[model samples]
Target: MRIALAQTEPLWEAKQENFRRAERFLKEAKEQQAELILFPEMSMTGFSMHPEKIGETEEEPETLNYFAKKAVEYGLYIGMGYVEYREPKSYNRYAIISPKGGVLTDYRKIHPFTFGTESVHYTGGDALGFCKIGDWTVSPFICYDLRFPEIFQLASPQVELIVVPANWPEDRVEHFKTLLKARAIENQCYIAGINRVGHARTSVYSGDSMIVDPLGRELAHGGREEELLVADLDLEMVWKYRAAFPAKIDRKPELYRKLADGMQI
Candidate 1:
């Protein structure tokens, strides 16, 4: 499958301007013949702490509706992030929209960025999110979830491709790149990390977006500028690599369970 990573520069809390910018990238991705396109976290609103100001409910999903329309217009699957409001609680959510103009699945960020005060504004999710795109089993995760490998490990056995949408800051971009490759190598699956560029209220994003193969090789990489990166992924490569390595088969889940239970090794 051909995938496009939209490395964008979201205007702070300005959904209309960001939607225009996103549409431009969507057109380019369509022209490139990409089957799926992934955008940065909070693609319409740069990382903002004021969920009360920007959050929308499932009943009133303005941002989700816009992307769903775009997905239908572009004739491709679209993955993007937004703030979800559920009464008094809010969530940092990622939604996958099918070409048929329907949402496949929406994943709430399991690990909110406590360091950035995101937890203060949003509630963490308890469930994993998965969707099927063509012949591939795909999973979606938000930014801080990338730091916690256990969630990725749990999803790895069932997913061939894992997509992470992030507003990861430029200061720790090296960590972002390293973690994406590491997750791909460890899980023997394709990993796509889509990030944003330009300055937000709190920090700057350098946009080190990347697409890594099962063997930790980069298929596509984006620089500091805003751009659309396209790459063709082969699910056969993931199956073949996992078969050759047999790493997942060697996992000692019983021991890990014991550790999780707080038993001495």
Candidate 2:
């Protein structure tokens, strides 16, 4: 499958303008023959904690509908993040839409960035989202979830590709790159991380979007500029490598139960 990461600079609290930009990017991705396109976390409204201003309920998700229309028009799968409001609480969520304008998945972020006080603003998700896309088993995860390897390990057995939409700051870009490659190497699955560029409030993002193959080879990468990074992934390569090496099969889950027993340093 051919994937395109839309490394865009979302205007803070400006949904319409961002939606316009996203449409242009989607058109470009379609022209490039990309089957799927990914945008960064909080795609329309940069990374803002003020959910009251940007959050949308599932019943009235204009942002999601906008992308769904674009997906159908462009004949490509679209994945974008937003703040989801569900009754009394809100969650950091990513939604996937098919080419026919159907909603494929709505994945709430499992791990909120506590250091950034995201936990205070949004609730963490109770479940992971996984779906079969083409020849690959695909999973969608949010920004802070990349720091937790256990979640990746749990999905690794069934997932062939993992997509992360992040609003990571420029200061911690090295950690982002390191963790992305680590996840790909450990799980033997392709990983695509799409981050934003430009400034959001006081924080600045460099947009180090990248696509890594199952073997930890970077197929495509983006720098500080707002652009699209595209790469073609082969599902056969994932199965071939896993069948030959079989590293995940060697994991001793029972022996590692102590990891959940809260051992302290």
Candidate 3:
């Protein structure tokens, strides 16, 4: 499948403006024959601590209905991240709008970045979910979750493609690239990382959006600017590399299961 990543500069705390920006990018991506397009974490409301400005998280579908229609119009899958205002709490989520104008998935971020007060405002996700679309099995994860390999490992063998929508900071640019490559290589799968650009009032994000192959090679990456990144994903390589490496089969599940039971490995 041909995937496109929008390295957009979100108007901090501006959901309407960001939604307009995403629509424009989706139109362009459709013209390029992209099957799926991805945007950064909280693409609609740029990452911010002000819950009042970002509380649209509750009525997520109200905002996503616009994109869902766009997906049907363009006949392409669109993945965008935003905040959901659920009762008593909000969530950091990525919504998948299918080509048929329906909600494919709502992936809430399991690892809420507690470094600041992110955890305080947002509720974390409990389970990871993957969906089958066309010839690809797409798994979703958020920003800080990239540091944990075990989660991706759990989704492994079943999913050949991983989508990471993040608002990664500029302070750790190297971490963004290296970890993406490592995840792609270790899992023998494709990794698409979409990050934002520009300095928000609270933080500056490194806009290094990239697509990595199963061999951990970068197919495309954006610099520190708003841009569109497209990369062709080869499904054959996912199987080819995994067949050669066979890491999934090497897992000591019995021992790992015991460890999860609080026993020594």
Candidate 4:
């Protein structure tokens, strides 16, 4: 499958303007023959801490509807991130829309960026999200979830590809790249890390979006520029690499239980 990453520079808290920009990028991806395309975290809102300004109610999600509409219109699978409003707080959400205009799944962000006060404003998700697109089993995660290897390991057994949409800052750009490669190599699955570029209210993003194979080789990478990185991924590579190396088959789950029990290192 061919995937396109929209390494965008979102207009701060401007949903409509960002939507217009996204539409233009979608058209460009279509011309490149991309089957699926992903956008950065808080795609249209630029990671606003105040949920009231940009988050939409779950009962009537305008951004999700727009993604579905675009998916149907372009005949492309769309993976997008947005803020979902609930009572008392909101959640960072990732929605995958099929080409047929139906939503495949909505994954709430399991880990909120506590350092940025995100956890205080948003509710964390309780479970992992799994879905299928074409011939691949996919799992979607938000920005901070990239730092937790346990979550990635939990999904590794079934997921062929993991998608991380982030608003990671420019100062920590190297950590963003290094972690993405580490996750892909350790889990033996394809990983697509899509991040935003330009300035938000609190920080600047450098847009180090990339698609890394199971062997941690980058298939496509975007620099600091606001653009799309399109690359073809073979679904067979995930299974082929796993079968040849079979690294995951040697895991000792029972022994690792001590880590979860809060045992001293």
Candidate 5:
């Protein structure tokens, strides 16, 4: 499958301007013949603490409607992030829209960025999400969830590709790149990390977006700019690599469970 990573620069609290920018990228991705396109976290609004101001409820769902329309218009499967409001609580959410304008998956950020006080404004998700695109099973995760390898490990056995939509800052850009490759290598699956660029209210992003293969090879990289990085992923490579290495088959789940619960090995 051919995938496009959209490294965008969203204007703070300005959904309209960001929508225009996103549409431009969507057109380009379509022209490039990409089957799927992934956008940065909070694609319409930059990372903002005020969820009440930018959050969209299911009843309202402005952001969701916009992307679904674009998914149909461009004839491409779209993955993007937004803030979801559920009564008193809000969630940082990643959603996948099918080419026919149907919602494929809605994955909330399982690990909120406590260091940035994101937990104060949003609720963490309790479950992992997966969707099927063509012959590939895909899993979607948000930014901070990339640091928690356990979640990725849980999804690895079932998925051939994992996608992370992030507003990861430039200060720790190296960590972002390293973790993407690490997850791909450890799981023997394709990993796509889509990030934003430009300055936001509290931090700056350099858009070090990357797509890594099962062998930890960097297939595509979007360096410090707003652009679309495209790459073709082969599912056969993932199965072949895992079959040869047999690393997942060697895991001692019972021992790991005991260790996680602080029991004697």
Candidate 6:
């Protein structure tokens, strides 16, 4: 499938401007003949703690329906981040919109950044999300979730591709790249990470969005500018690699369960 990652330089907590920027990017991605378009972390609101600022409905709200409708109109699948309302609280969420403008799934950010007020403003989702789009079984994750490999492992051999939407800091560019490659190599799946650019509230993001093949090779990467990282990948490659070097099959799940149950690593 042809995948496009829009590494956006977002407007700090400004909802409308962010949407305008994303709409332009989506149009360009569609023009490029992309089947699926991915956006950076919190593409709509610039990754902030002011949950009270975002509204519930589509009008004055963050207006996710706008993107949904655009997806249908353009006949493209879109995966973008926003703060979704959940009555008394809100959650950092990714909306995977189908080509027909329908919501395929809404994956909430399971791992909240405790260093910021993310823990204060949002609650975590109970389950890790995995879904099928066309022929690909894909998984979605947010920024800090990259540190935990088990979440991706839970998806197992089912997920052929994993997408991470991150607001990673500029100083830790190496760590961000390291984990992206590690996730692809260890999971034996294709990985596409979209990170934002520019500074927001004293935190400058390193915009190194990329697409990695099953062999842990980066096919496409973005710079510290608002741009689209595009690449074509084969879904069958995951099975091809793992079958030749069946490491996951050789895993000692029985003993590992004990280690995962809090025994020292």
Can you tell me which runs of candidate 3 are displaced by over 4 Å?
57-60, 260-265
lDDT of each: 0.93, 0.91, 0.85, 0.92, 0.93, 0.84
Better of 1 and 6 by TM-score: 1
Tens digits of per-residue lDDT for model 1, 67-155 = 99999999999999999976556899999999999999999999989899888888899999999999999999999999999999999
Least lDDT summed over 10 consecutive residues: which range in candidate 4?
256-265
TM-scores, all candidates, are 0.97, 0.97, 0.94, 0.97, 0.97, 0.93
**Could you tell me how far off, in angstroms, the CA of residue 157 lies in candidate 3 after the best superposition?**
1.9
- CA-RMSD of model 2: 1.3
Tens digit of per-residue lDDT, candidate 2, span 26-100: 989999999999999999998888999899976899888898888888999999998887655689999888899
Q: Candidate 1: worst 10 consecutive residues by lDDT?
A: 81-90
Q: Compose the digit string of candidate 6's lDDT tens values, residues 99-133.
A: 88777777888888888768878888878777678
Residue 215, model 1: Cα distance from true site in angstroms = 0.4
Model 6: lDDT to the true structure? 0.84
Residue lDDT tens for model 5, 187-251? 99999999999999879999989999998999999888899999999989888888889998888
Off by over 4 Å in 1: 263-265
Model 6 TM-score, all chains together: 0.93
Model 2 lDDT at residue 76: 93
**What is the clash count for each candidate, in the order shown?**
0, 0, 5, 0, 0, 0
Over 4 Å off, model 2: 262-265
What are the candidates' C-alpha RMSDs?
Answer: 1.3, 1.3, 1.9, 1.2, 1.4, 2.1
The positional error of residue 250 in candidate 6, measured at the CA in angstroms, is 1.4
